[model samples]
Target: MRAFKGFRKDLTCLGFQFREDKINRTEEANCVKNGFHCAENPLDCFHYYSDWRNSVYYEVDAGGDLDEDAVDSKISCTEMRLIRRLSLEQMLFEAAVYMVEHPKRQWNYGVKKETGTACNGYGVVRGKNPRAAGEKGDFLLILKEEQNSPEIEEIALINIDGKRWHPHKFYDAYGK
Candidate 1:
């Protein structure tokens, strides 16, 4: 069995955006059939990873009435998604550091949060909303050589989301 390496906690927040060049026809079809208008060119589909190592530690030193009815709950998952996106971007920045240090490596590897882990099936909380927004989750991932690279003959992405392991390639628009 190949060794599965874990991603740095700091790079957990690399926001994942669907490659804009690729259009998911199935998603588009569903939206049209349901009469639900979605943001055109929706690219926020991939699961984002974050780097938790650089996260600022906040010490909870005070305790107050934590009643659910006391505070007006107006948080939405959309806002949470925005925050998560930003964290993921920051994590990507941290990943650059690693890539620069390890020039010989072909790709960065890391794990993403699994859906069946904890609350809401999310992994760990990478950030928080001041007004009680959605919670963030964590997972694992690592950068590996691109499958079928000239330097490294064949590489594959073992997708855990599915039952069987399959090989994937970095495809651009027009299936390049």
Candidate 2:
């Protein structure tokens, strides 16, 4: 979450320009609240914030079980795929909407190539599911600590697609 705080500041530091007479303070505030900033040079801020967010998200989900359910065992592989597709669609729609709303602050799609590279190289790499080995086996120590403990009820799944899935942590009655 500290990374989120940094992202917000980076976004604000980037600043935003408006075509209207007055800048929208509310919009900027909303961005800050949502772990983003209102950048005058959105393209630059977009790259900065996106890179930062991607890294943080990767670190958070580096060691969780991606196959687990939120509350019940109803999340099958098929259902999970559907949910992932839907979530991706929603994210794309939101990005499109943002671009449309802020035409003056043109959005750049160039970062797509390097989107997950930072996270992959430094955060979490693919085909390397940390949970598969053991909680403490991954490069991320914090993730191991959280997963090894029975008290941690929630786990974050950082998939290759750059999305987060919060799955419930289930254990035996004796708290195994």
Candidate 3:
């Protein structure tokens, strides 16, 4: 079955180095150990690995005995072939496509669940991040990729909050 797997930037998962040129196999899959683990949905890979900037994803064809979860798309199998490594854009595209079929469980990268507004997100290396010089990263998932608008400011990454963040240094009434 077609599946998605996350790996360190070096192509290692757990401690094993997987080769893209060949089919990889292991002992029969057992929960968190003994097999190659993957997910049916691309975004579900994030629940297991979140270093989006430094990690990589692959389209794998998992064969042989498989153990699948009843609820989510988690799966483990003894055989897998790394079909291809996905680029950042490809990862987004795959996730977006999968989310169309499973809309309710999409990853809330930057949007707030209750308010449906932009929220804090993971930081990125400015030069390596796809966002423009001052543009936001995760906010792009929503419609908030507004450039230099007064809404986004020059605050450091960690201090960015939904409220009281401004290009100016003074605190507004909200004390954020």
Candidate 4:
């Protein structure tokens, strides 16, 4: 089965180190003891490893005997082959879409802000929000604001040079 797996930034999962494009297998397939685990959706990975900054996710194929979660898409298998790693944008976009589709689960997502705006490349990206018709670029994302309070974690946009900035800093620099 094709699945999404979460691992440490160093590519370690369940105390085992894995390399890209390599197949790793265990002699046993016990979900509670010795088995490989993955989720069908990338977001479900947060359930296992919540530290986004330090965790990396990959696309993989899981074989052998499997145990599936009744509540979610998590699966435990004896064999796993890493397909490739996923990009941060791909992961964050999933969270973004989840934030929009499940507004009631906003607190769980932890990114949408309670204001009207477009997240830019300057504050978040180091450039202004794209304003031209059908203009596409590297980082600007337009999201409908979720009305709430000051508790939601603002999404940070990183510049090409590697500095991370938040939208509030953008407004502060340019006067919102």
Whichever of 1 and 4 has more TM-score, that candidate is 4
Ranking by lDDT: 3, 4, 2, 1
Strongest candidate by TM-score: 3
Q: What lDDT score belongs to each candidate, Candidate 1 first? A: 0.21, 0.23, 0.57, 0.55
Model 2 spans with C-alpha error above 4 angstroms:
1-37, 40-45, 50-91, 103-105, 109-176
How should the candidates be ordered by TM-score, best one leading? 3, 4, 2, 1
Q: What is the lDDT of residue 4 in candidate 3?
A: 92
Write down the RMSD of all candidates, one decimal each: 20.8, 18.8, 10.4, 9.0
Which lDDT tens digits does candidate 4 get at residues 1-176? Answer: 97788899999986898877667888766655678988765667776876656888887899988987565567889889998787656665554454445544424322223222332321111112212111123333333332352222233332222234333232321222
How close is every model to the real structure, measured as TM-score? 0.18, 0.20, 0.62, 0.54
- Candidate 2 structure quality by residue, lDDT tens digits, 110-153: 22211122221122111112231112111111111124332223
For residues 9-113, what per-residue lDDT tens digits would candidate 3 score against the true structure?
A: 998999989999989988788655578899888756766777677788999999988998654688999999999988655654565455444444534343222
Q: Taking the tens digit of each residue's C-alpha lDDT, what string does model 1 give over 105-142? A: 43222212111122221121111110011123322122
Better of 2 and 4 by lDDT: 4
lDDT for model 3, please.
0.57
Better of 3 and 4 by lDDT: 3
Model 1 lDDT, full chain set: 0.21
Question: Among these predicted structures, which one has the highest lDDT?
Answer: 3
